[model samples]
Target: MHSDRHEPAPLRVELAGARLAGPAPVPTGVTASRPAAAVPHPTPTQPLSPARLDTPSTWPRRTLLRLVGASAVGLPVVAALAACAEDDTVHPPDPLAAQEVLARADAAAATAAIALAPGSHAALSTIATERTAHADALRTEIDRVIGVYGDGTTPVHRTGALTVPGPGGSPVPASEVETASAQPSTLDGVRDQLVRSQQSAAALARTESGYRAGLLASISAACATQAGVLLT
Candidate 1:
């Protein structure tokens, strides 16, 4: 009798770099194998360095531009403030400025008086001499107070020669007397000028102290004597 059952077909297997043909039996009671759990690789770390640590590199372009612009603007402002601080020095006006002007005017008036009244030459000459002396003394004091530079050169004065009212009620430089072509002033006009000068000196003396006050007081007394006694 012929066999009723047929043998199983041959099994073919494929593997890496190899091939096999055989009647391999399928194993029972074995669990299917899963591919080994894929392992994750750690990311590489960069070394810490100044180039890597610099935060400005990470700043936004707009933010970096703003900071640079601020620094540029602030530098000029700081320089300007420094310059202003250096230029803040102040020079006060000289105290004897008005007195010097008055003395010079008195001298001119006394000299003019002599020319106007030849009969009173003796008294007028004395007055002119004394008045000129007062002007010279005042000028000397002013120059001494002004002081010289390191090179023995006198500094440029801020105060210039002031003007006084002339006999014609117009202003003229204190250094110059009105010309004869102008309105001729009488002895009474000279006396009036002396009186004003005396009053000015007396008023200023009260405000001053020390040597300056004494000088002004002496000037005031001399002017009073010339106006009240000499001119009379």
Candidate 2:
């Protein structure tokens, strides 16, 4: 007697580049289905054009105008900021400048006093010499603070004054040296000016430090002696 069970068909694989022997046979009891439609692949997009990379004309008009406007406004602001930075670095006016001026004025007043009152010649002469020395010392310190460049040239500063001019753009003439209140003699005027110089120097000394403070204090003491002791 023959068996009723059927054997399954063997799988067939075609080699690459080779044709199939014939169409594959469908298994028994399975319905044959139609082949699925081929799916079309999307087309590849082309790369950006190299010629358009630097072409401003290809850019939007509004975008180009905005960029140009930003640059135009930004450049001046940057320049202004640079200018402000430079200004901040600049040295401030030296405090010693006023002291030097006071010293010179005091010396001039002492000299004028000598001519006005012949009896006080010796004392006035000594005061004038000391005041002149004080002015010179102040000038030396100012120069030292300004410093010199690598090329041996002095740094540019507003403190350089070959001659300290008095009020009205001239040396303190004898006539202008007179005090506001009428004094009996020129010695009184000299003494008053010395007192003012001493007070100014003493006040400034309190604010200064190091060598400058010591120097101002010494000058102030000297002015006090000249006004209170020598003049009297």
- Give the Å shift of residue 124 in candidate 1: 1.0
Clashing pairs in 2: none
lDDT of each: 0.70, 0.74
**Residue range 133-218, candidate 2, lDDT tens digits:** 99999989988987765567665554222332344435442334334222334888778778877887898899999999999999
Total clashing residue pairs per candidate?
0, 0
RMSD of each: 14.8, 11.7
Error of 1 at 93 (Å): 4.4
TM-score of each: 0.51, 0.51
Angstrom error of the Cα, residue 132, model 2: value is 0.5
Model 2 ranges off by over 4 Å: 1-91, 150-152, 159-185
Q: Model 1, stretches more than 4 Å misplaced? A: 1-93, 160-184
> Number of the top candidate by lDDT?
2
Candidate 1 achieves a global lDDT of 0.70
